[model samples]
Target: MSTPELHWFKSSFSSSSEPGDCVEVARTPAMIHVRDSKTPGTSHVTVASATWESFLAYVTE
Candidate 1:
């Protein structure tokens, strides 16, 4: 499938200079898109907005 058109946000904590790991994210009306920031041109995964928010909240807790 073609990549969806949406606004993506790169984490401030991400190191764009050099990296073994990095994450990129985007938001849709009902979902969140995430993928390796280092290889954004590759693949991305989508999750429900509520699940995404819950995961973030849990991680921050």
Candidate 2:
């Protein structure tokens, strides 16, 4: 199967003062994709939608 199109974007909360310290994210119905902003095309991590939500909840807490 072909890969789905991803709309990658960096977080507004990122600390831009530090180079390469930001992360980018992309979302699909089934998964949430994350990668380092500095090297986005080189590597990424994908997580289940539910797991991504849980991680956000924990991080925001």
Candidate 3:
């Protein structure tokens, strides 16, 4: 099946001074997509929504 188009956005925590050094994220109903902002055309990593949420909670704590 074809992958659906994703709407990506740079993380707010990313350093604005270094535009090329930012991380981008896209969300779906059950998945979260991540990629380097500088290399948007390259491959991205996908994880379950729950896993992404757990990761965020861990890192933020």
Candidate 4:
């Protein structure tokens, strides 16, 4: 099977004023993908949607 293409985007909080210092994110139905804008080729992390949501809630709280 082949993986579907993902559309990655920088965080809204990420300003053009800072170069290569932001997080990029992409998503699928079941997983959230996260990577560093500075090193897109190095490595990345994938987490469950629920885990990602919980993380966001905790951080925002």
lDDT (CA) per prediction: 0.81, 0.87, 0.91, 0.88
Q: Residue-wise lDDT of candidate 3 within 1-61, one digit each (tens)?
A: 9888999999766888976899899999999999999889999999999999998999789
Expressed as tens digits, the lDDT of each residue in 2-55 for candidate 1 is 866878788655776776566778887899889886687888898999998898
TM-score, every prediction: 0.72, 0.83, 0.88, 0.86
Candidate 3 accuracy as TM-score: 0.88
- Answer with 2 or 3, whichever has the higher lDDT: 3
Cα miss at 22, model 3 (Å)?
A: 0.7
Question: Better model by lDDT, 1 or 2?
Answer: 2
At residue 29, what lDDT does model 2 achieve?
A: 92
Taking all chains together, the TM-score of candidate 2 against the true structure is 0.83
Full-model lDDT, candidate 2: 0.87
Which ranking of candidates, highest TM-score first?
3, 4, 2, 1
TM-score of 1: 0.72
- lDDT, candidate 2, 1-61, per-residue tens: 9998899888766887997799889999999999888786697999999998898889989
Better of 2 and 4 by TM-score: 4
Candidate 4 ranges with C-alpha deviation above 4 Å:
13-17
Instruction: Pull out the clashing pairs in model 2.
Output: none
Clashes of each: 0, 0, 0, 0
